[model samples]
Target chain A: MDVLTTPLTAFSQYFSKSDYVLALPMILLTVFALGILMIDLMLPEEWKRLNALTALIGLGFSAAAVFRIHSLLGPEVSCIPGFFGTVVMDRFAVYFFYLFLVGAAVAVLMSVKYLEIERENHGEYYALILFSVIGMMAMACGYDIIMLFIGLELMALSTYVLVGFLRRDQRSNEAALKYLILGAFSSGIFAYGLSLFYGLTGSTNLGTIAQGLEKRISANPNDPVVIFALLAVSTGLLFKIAAVPFHQWAPDAYEGAPTAITGFMSVAVKSAAWALLLRMFLFGFYPLRALYVPMLIFVALATLTGGNLAAITQTNTKRLLAYSSIAHVGYMLLGLIASDGTSNTTGIKGIMFYLLVYTFMNLGAFAVIASLRRREIIGDDLDDLAGLYKKAPVEAVLMLIFLLSLAGIPPLAGFYGKYFIFLSLVETGHFALAGIAVLYAVVGLYYYLKMANAMFMREETTAEPVKSSPSMSLALAICAIGTIGIGLFPNVFIELVNWSMSGANAATIAQLMH
Target chain B: MMPVATTFFFYFLSIIAVVSAIVVITRKSPVHSALALITTLLSLAGLYLMLYAPFVAAVQIVLYAGGIMVLFLFVIMLVNLEKAQLEERFNKQWQVALIAVLTLGALLIFIFEKGRSVFPQTVTNFPENTNTQVIGLLLYRDYLMPFELASLLLLVAIVGAVVMAKKRV
Candidate 1:
């Protein structure tokens, strides 16, 4: 017994408890998704909401794991290397993991009633969302290019199907097909760039890639491969984030998708893509800052104007939100542009805070829109929401909160998100760009106010009262609280965001100097 | 072993690859284009073999030529191409796209020629040994994470195929 146990113990030592904790959220999600699929097969039609309950429980467990791991992360971004350094558990990744969990939970809550209303309530919906979360978790934590690409695919493929879930609806099918084609093309471009990066560095782990890139750049100042890699990777990622020139599919997809799914895409997908972009550039392409910064500046200006100007023309609320989301991507890019590729805490912090605020504000707005949608109504137009104040006072009030926040009015979550980015831009001496962004933001206010006015002033077209479910209300309450909580008590969130980025900035600066 | 033979084969492969690629773009019939693509892929695989990358050659044939080509043809058959052909052959913005592409091509050529010295020109030193053992060891040890992640990607693809393609489910 002693002889047999000795070898087993040796093998077990190769794996550790930290590995389990580092990957806890992804593990919980995958298991629950599979478990739901199995149980869904056995359950009767009346027990459909049971799948939503299981998904919620799964999300809860993952959220609990995130909290447990939260204390382990120090103020300094501590990288707990697991799986041969492919998965780096850091404060930055932890922040996003928490975001993904909260977003998934809200989506689940919204899905329960939304699916029931549409009569397409099934277990697959919950399972696919969980699968997408698993992908997001992977994207957040992955330190290697392969891990990141696979995660991106997992997320994209699942969402593509989720978009076309309503097979009977022609608009949904059209949007899904368009998304799939463009998404796959961008992925190919991304893979080509990644392969070139691998060829030059002879490695895929971002830390080593950065080290290799640093050496290569120092050896030859104008390495053409460096410029090409930047073009390829940035283009691929920009498409995913719905930035300009590559954002054509976003409005159609967002307008056509299930409202909860639209919210999920707006929040979860944006967060994951931005995280990957930060990791790649801040860590991997820091040496070529001069080459990439100008590219980002042009992109930021284009995205800001394109998204806002297009959004102004949209009469459909969902399409308007879609373009608005693109515009928000432009603001977030300002944060990236201001980052000195070193210890620029304000820049990364601003981006992180904005994403967090956005998850709540955007999801809250979408949740209200989902609640309004009925079979006969299909009420996504501005007219449908007319005089919402009279029909559902509470919903109208919640929508107003979201609109004001989005409009960047003071004492709301959205304002702070924009304020931080603007501060960072000003601090970096990009005063002119900051001025332009503010001007566009003012233009953005008009459309948002138009919708707010529709909700408040116009008379209702129909006689019946607007309604909602307990689950939808619960989701809305969480979002409303998140929106107000971060806006009012800025100290706590700012401190946390500052700490999360503390490790990455100092480490990046130190790595370069050596 | 013969320099002349190698040169002749290189030219043969290049002609096949380029010709087939042009056919793939220009052919009106989808099936003909797909078949042309398979030929192009196979010729590229031959070039890989000539470069002493037997393993890559095998994969190019198996995955791209065999697996992906089948999928491409399946999709082409599924769609109604006759109706598609009746529509406009080119986009309204084709002139703009063409100019951008031409400019990009010129810039790429200039960069390659000017920066030729910076780019490493590695000597052809193919290992006499096979790659099977090397890749296997690397996959099992050094690239364990990516290796497993590949499986997860396939699983997602399977799920997507079912969820999107199947009508009854």
Candidate 2:
């Protein structure tokens, strides 16, 4: 009885502020999600394509809403109310929310053709993707550990189903089982860490946790529980990001899951996880730098070595890219480590910029792969890509741009992304790590170039040309444009990156130096 | 209730949790393994009660032990379990297991050695307020967004599960 009356009062209280600008995007996305669901249910089987169309519309509106909100709220505003203080509306979160929306939109576009080809096209697929997008948005904006965990699980559980969407396939089943078991295990570890943190800090909000850590560190200085709890939490996050030593499931899962969904997972999931990682580490655990920096550095090195070495031997293209992504994670971690000891915006900017560039090039690369045909004669082997240039010149060229970008070739988005990241490392005096990262980048170039060479240089084995859907062509074109545009006019993107990093750096310095 | 009985119960529950966890991992049949998992989860609920978090204990029993485990059992039953034909889906790495055990033992020793400096015993009374009440207040007041978002997560999970289990279009 009280609950009924209370929400009405709460609603009235919320409206009295007359400042719904901060909440407009969430409101828009929520409404759009429900609208899409309704449309999905109302549409007939043949009109199921409307689901994808509706999702695209929803995402577009949400993206526009985000821009409007950003404009209205300015850069560094926090609109927290009630007791929860769970959702934060700041530039840092807004940046990620936009990224999630764009990534999901591209993923939906990429899925259209793949789903059609596999004859597994369904409205639920689109709906689930939107749901996962909502989860990613929540995770990105979450200000507290409980919100983070719920959002993480929401995304994970949905992806688990998405991974095993092709139920009859043995590999898909295996992937789902592996993911479920490992995901549950990691979640349990994370929850235990949360419990430990709660025991020590008596709070779950990131800001409160930071305050507690500052106090505890000054008092105890060398308590092992502090380090243990930090390790456990980082371990859980590391699992999510698929960093080395915990990346065993990534390759198999990527190889087995539908290619389009794999693309979505690689970009959207990684971006969201990194967003959460940045928030947690930079905000909540900044005072414990001595505990995290060295551990992260070692993990980065291991991830680089393991990812590159494993990629060199991979026969399947998807698995190869999976390992490649792991290596990219290593590079991203370099940005995190570079942010240590100083409140420089360059390092964080580099990370954010790279994530932006990566979303395009990586997804574009996967789009090209999704278009390739095995022909039952030459499966998804390296040989299948032979003479792709002659068979499908447009795709081959687009694929070239993606591979070049990923390899950090000049005049491509990938190059600028790496350039900024390396610049940050050097600026932070992480010269040795940056040097090692360059060396690994060269090693990565080998495999990416191999794919490019196979597509562009090798002669066609079959007379039949590869066919692709118009939707895929459009998606690839968008990615190509983004990759080249960001590379050429990087200043605009650089400004955006700078703006996002300023908030993060200010918050980090304020908490750490206190 | 003597403190001795409380201590005994703690030890017994801990042993059961460990044993059940082991069984959950080792059992050949997925169904049997899932059942063992339920036992492990129940014992964990008991452990939660011992820790003075009765609300968490209740949640553990209701959500995990009752709700989630049932879903797991149902899914296991729904899937053609014959396909599993358990020859260990994962590679058998006894060496890694042995290494894990040894590492755990070493860690325990280190923990004991360091315990003196860190967790010095101080007799303190547990808070009088009920765990449920406190948690409810925190959830509704401090963690309201997360509480609401958790419902959203459940809604997504329900939608996703139905989608995945449905007949292909």
Residues A1-514, model 1: lDDT tens digits? 1221111122232446666676788788888988988898899988999999999999999888887777666543355567666777667788898888889899989988888777777788899999888888888878889888988888888899888877777888998999999999999999999988887777887877788888888987778787798799999999999999899999999988888999999998889888888877887777778788899999999999999999999999999999999999999999999976454667778899999999999999999998898767777898989989988999999999998898899899999899999999988999999999999999999999999989998998877566788999999999999999988998888887877787566556554453
Using Cα atoms with residue i matched to residue i, what is each candidate's TM-score against the true structure?
0.84, 0.81
For candidate 1, please provide the TM-score of chain A on its own: 0.95
Off by over 4 Å in 1: A1-17, A75-77, A219-221, A341-343, A510-514, B1-118, B121-130
- Cα lDDT of model 2 by residue, B58-115, tens digit: 8999999999988998898888787776466557798898899999999999978976
Report the alpha-carbon TM-score of model 2 versus the true structure. Answer: 0.81
When superposed on Cα atoms, how far off is each prediction in RMSD? 5.8, 6.8
Q: Worst 10-residue stretch by lDDT in candidate 2 chain A?
A: A1-10
C-alpha DockQ of every model? 0.33, 0.35
Model 1 chain B lowest lDDT segment of ten: B119-128
By summed lDDT, which 10 consecutive residues of candidate 1 chain A come out lowest? A1-10
